[model samples]
Target chain A: MACDARGKTTTIKILTGLLRPSEGQAYIWGVDVEKEPEHAMSRVGAVVETPELYPELTPLEILTYVGRLREMSPDAIRDRSKVVLDEVKMSEWADKRTGKFSKGMKQRVGIAQALLNQPDLLILDEPTGGLDPRGMAEVRDVIKGLGRSGITVFMSSHLLYEVQETCDSVALINKGKLLMYDDLARISLWRKGGRVEVEALPPIPPEIVERVQAAPGVKSVRGPDGNRIVVELEGGDEERAALLRQLLGWGLRVRSFKDVEMPLESLYLELVKESR
Target chain B: MATEGATQPTVPQAPQPTVPQADRRTARGARFLIVARFELMRQLRRRRLLILLIITAIFLVLLIVVIQVFRTASADSYSYASSFGGFVPTLAALAATFFGADALVGEFEHRTGYLLFPQPVTRTSIFLGKLVAGFSLTAVTLAVYYGVVATATAIVTRGLPIEIAYSFLLAVLYSTAALGVAFVLSSTLKGTTSASVMTFAVLFLMLAIVTAIFSVADLRPDGNLAFAGGTISNILSGPYPQAYPGDTEFPGGPGPGGRFRVYSPAVPLSILVMAIWAAVGFGLAWALYRRKEMKG
Candidate 1:
């Protein structure tokens, strides 16, 4: 998220039939959400934007009610509700009224309610929006578990780290415009870094920076390290070898020269910067 | 109904037993009943119901105290019961306004529909469930009120009149009518508070407008809900009141007499009017509810 995440939530609400789209259409399982919302939404489960539970109801009660609406058998509803409550780690508070629960606890119950019908698609809009660090970790673990259970999870977040940690793929949006969307690994690899850090056995002199900057195929140079120099190469495999040879010819000992960087953060920043 | 037992759902004994939904119509009916059952239990658990119970009890007690203070509480129980008979429909209207008004709007206002609308049920199912829930609770709340009146009347008179049964039926019918009106307002409105206030105003204040309109028109207020309410209370007035031209000037004036004809509809006509309100209001509300998006 470059800024806000309203677009992610609005899209979820529209697909869940809680809101109507002014233009175009959305579908689930080949059924149109606008024209056949009952059919479409039945196949999808969503928890949108700080969903509030009935304060008078317990988690078991709310889940059972939702299951009953889905026409689950009474025993099935009971067992399913218990299973969902356990999945969200609220088995002990299953019987307690949610009126007195923390925001995180309410969010858990909301997630459990969404899981009652066990739909093919589970859409959660900021499932852990305002939780404390510990609360966020708990919810994130549950989400990650759900992600691995063969159920499709579509989660939106403004916290880049949270998305990086919990999501297999990421969609970054800015001001309703999708800036980038790809597998995290693939996106990270697209921008191969060209800078190499040289940890020299014998530290290079401060005046040697100008000579290294003047070396062929070396675009830039920085750092008078304990015994190292960083060289930004213009391109290719030969540039680093030539730069290392030149450094050694100057009576400098290089211990290790390595290209070490993942480009996801750089890519994200570049995209966001370009978009802005 | 025997479904009162079914409504109290527990864990099923069978393991994932499949109930075949052979048709959308049949499926809708089953879903309607399930949601209605859920909503009924929901209302029973609401704290506001308890408050309504308290308010009704205090009103009844004060009524009895007022009658006793007038030294007529000791009168023959049949007449005494009829003296306080009007409270039934009044309570029905009041209860419908208090509880039923917010039933549908709160589902959206409180964002409860976020959980409800994504289910396999249709909007009509949601509306019907809520209507049934409000009707069930209103009936129960009215039951307690009538219970006190009935038990006291029976104890003193040593007998129960068949006409009081008719009166009770009218009260329940009237309650259903009021619920229909409340639901119609709830489905179309945005907020619970506004829906409730407008529903209450439409329930009682409509009577004021009706009275004034008919008074100015020099016509009888036969089609009014309040008129049916009068017929409800009149069923226990020893005999069913007849419809006839009343002692009036047949012209415009706000005074009681010599103003305009007041229509005390015969039992059948009154029942017809109340039924129309119930059917049409309930139908229109369902229609509107189906189109009402959960924008919240």
Candidate 2:
């Protein structure tokens, strides 16, 4: 599963081989998380909500410590940590204490730590939460790259645009309930409708507005600009053709025609409203 | 086009090997050690710990000098040494108790616990690692104090006896037990200040007030019926009473000065009480930590 900043994601860390779920079981590469959690979690890397770095330690030192927990050799830890830090573009600040790092730098350090072992499942929550636009792009690219490398990326964020741009598939959750789970394109398909900006040859007649609203498969009709009326159709090409014919039959001139794609923010708000 | 594509060499492939499961486990252990080392290093670098150690060391040195000067001035050196030795356990207990009371509680107050809980490692490992580090630091401080006392005593007396050495060792052990009690209390208390206050209050009540009541009851005419006083006496004498009066004289008293009195509770009972407290405290900390939600 992959999620961008826009989707709601929930992550639970059940310690390797120590805890069993109260309701269900989780598996890691066919190994039960509760029964063989160590084996299962060995292939998992996570960057929880906050950067878990020790504030007193430098970024390099923190990475080295986490590397040691994995029992990596001294040379391997040094090499891997160097590469990860460089990947996160934090090598310049590797020696600086984490307490002094900005929010974006801390987020990068968190990502670097999570990517250390290159686990099969990389779970990140609001990975770009505190980053500026450039930092957000950097993290988004890193996550996309991880997904390309065959890692399952599960992320959750309140930013709809980020999720739409980064995720291949999304599961929309609100108040702990699943709203929609599908490919982004499929969700975006729900936005299909013909939108036209109409300026009458002379001027629009009230009779034409009534006639268009009364046409088949016309969901709604509104005049956004004085000279333009946007008609939302319920069907695809067939509905659009029928509406155009009816409008022409009413002697209304169609100045221009266009299709509108719903923005993710609007779609999210619509889903949230529908659920409620 | 096909020939050109074929002629273009692919990126060099690095050799990868399948590590055995045992090897992977070893790797994880290494990672845990790195984490443990980082934890220790962080504590070592703390200004508070450094200041505490420095202040403790200076105070210990001055305390030894004063004790030695007073011991030499008093003609009854043996009685003074014995009395002083008896107070060592209580003093050590008081220090360790207060130190332990702030151990975990302070971390919570500072919101540092959240940073460690979400890792792949279990809470047990985190707790054990921190406890080991904290205990080691406390032990080192206590050892330094012991060394200072020993040196001062030898200088004052011109030689040291085997009994003093034994008593000092026992005192160290009692301090460890007291530290365990405080550690457990630290985990139980919600706030660092409250934990410290409660720990000191409990130590003072048990060592001083309880001992005083017991002494008063033992002097009562009818030994059979002082309920609160008798209970206090039993509590003091039943387990780990510090000083037990033997065949030595009571110094600076009207009666003969050869009577010996035991004050603190017995070592074995103190150990048991401390162990139970540690166990319960640790158990509660583990449960609460395991269930705690990590907020961003």
Candidate 3:
């Protein structure tokens, strides 16, 4: 989900049984969180908004502590700590104290502990909120890997790109209101229309641009941004292919013609603006 | 990175392990021990424990220096042990405030609760675990101090007073009461330093003020933990000090003040009062902790 400073964290907190809702009830895996928090929380492994670990302890010790809380056997904690630590790429630092760890390293450890219980559901809140580019990519990769492992991952972030890259479905919220909830593809292609970027040899004339614009199912043609022009086209794959063919027949040396990917940022902005 | 259209290698996922079903009592008991063990380790690693031990050593040395300076070599073993136990209440308060002042509050203040509170364990388990750990640390410190006094009494007076054991028991009771108060403050306060200062202040300054008021008003300060702690030393006196309530000639004569009022609760009553303080303090702390939220 993508939401700006709204109630995303609050909702996640309630779901994780951190806060008792003033009204309304929430459930996790058929168990009411407020009614049976221990049972509900047992199924969930969560990292809520920059979890801070005990600096005096090593990652191994911290994970062991969490494992014990989960009521796992000592042998299980040992074996599982190794696997989860490796999953987050924190095995090398497992025994090292977290006091002097970099933010990225600590974040990785946070993810590691959340995975220690082998929970059925994983919830992360802005896993890459504060990190360098490399750290963000690494964390995104870890999150994506977890998603592919079949554990249901529900993550909330304001970064559209991160959600776009890491999540299969998206839930957008604004002003504590859920604006939309659907698969990523559906939201990105909600209008049954998209922009197609065309790259051809330089010195292409304006007649071709006009012809492309006048083609059936084409909404508008914008910019020869360097060697590229973005054609706003309606309908699906067949119409886009037909337009590419017509452009080729117009005696234009079209090097490439591909549908421009609609960034989730645009959809998020539009949805948020419309909500307001 | 796997590119688009490339067949992604199937990574084996970790097995989803369900938490084993133990009887609720056994599970809570096991978790309590685990938390207490780790909590104890956390406290043991801190420099504050060492600081408290060093302070105890300094106080012991001071006791020896005073004994030599005052030339009280003829004092009996009971008097020597009583003098040693006299410092128990102050040391116990210091120990409780130092070890337990941030016991619960630190979880929120230092952001550790963000990780801890989401676990499957119940808040009751966490509270009891922390209380046991704090009590253990305080009790152990008191034990060590009393152990030294016992050894000194054995060496200097060539005899051990049986009352030393009772004195030690009262000292521990007093410390537990102090720790209970500290835990209450820790759970309710938002900052660790404030909780620690408030605990020390409440135990020493605030309670002392209440005891003094009770004394001046000619009411027995039996309910005051500060006044009740006097039983730790009073038990060692051959003839326990009798309550000279209302007005009487000063024990030290009218050298300074003319008349003085004294208040002393019996040993059994003092023990009961201290136990009540500890129990009520812990019960109140647990109640507050159960409802406390980690807003930050």
Q: What is the C-alpha lDDT of each candidate?
A: 0.73, 0.58, 0.80
Candidates 1 and 3 compared: the better one by lDDT is 3
Q: After superposition, how far is residue B53 of candidate 1 from its true place, in Å?
A: 3.7
- Candidates 1 and 3 compared by DockQ, better number: 3
Best-to-worst lDDT order = 3, 1, 2
Ranking by TM-score: 3, 1, 2
For model 2, what TM-score is found for chain B? 0.62
Worst 10 residues of 2 chain A by lDDT: A1-10
Query: What does the lDDT read for residue B282 in candidate 3?
Result: 96
TM-score of each: 0.77, 0.75, 0.84
**What DockQ does each prediction reach against the true complex?**
0.25, 0.19, 0.36
lDDT of 2 by residue, B226-247 (tens): 1111221232221123343222
Which window of ten consecutive residues has the lowest lDDT sum in model 3 chain B? B1-10
**Each candidate: how many clashes?**
3, 38, 0
Q: In candidate 3, which residue pairs get closer than 3 Å at backbone N, Cα or C atoms, i.e. clash? A: none
Candidate 2, superposed: residue stretches over 4 Å from native? A1-37, A189-208, A232-267, A273-276, B1-35, B73-115, B163-175, B178-263
Ranking by DockQ: 3, 1, 2
Q: B170 in model 2: Cα distance from truth in Å?
A: 4.0
Query: Candidate 3 iRMS, in Å?
Result: 8.7
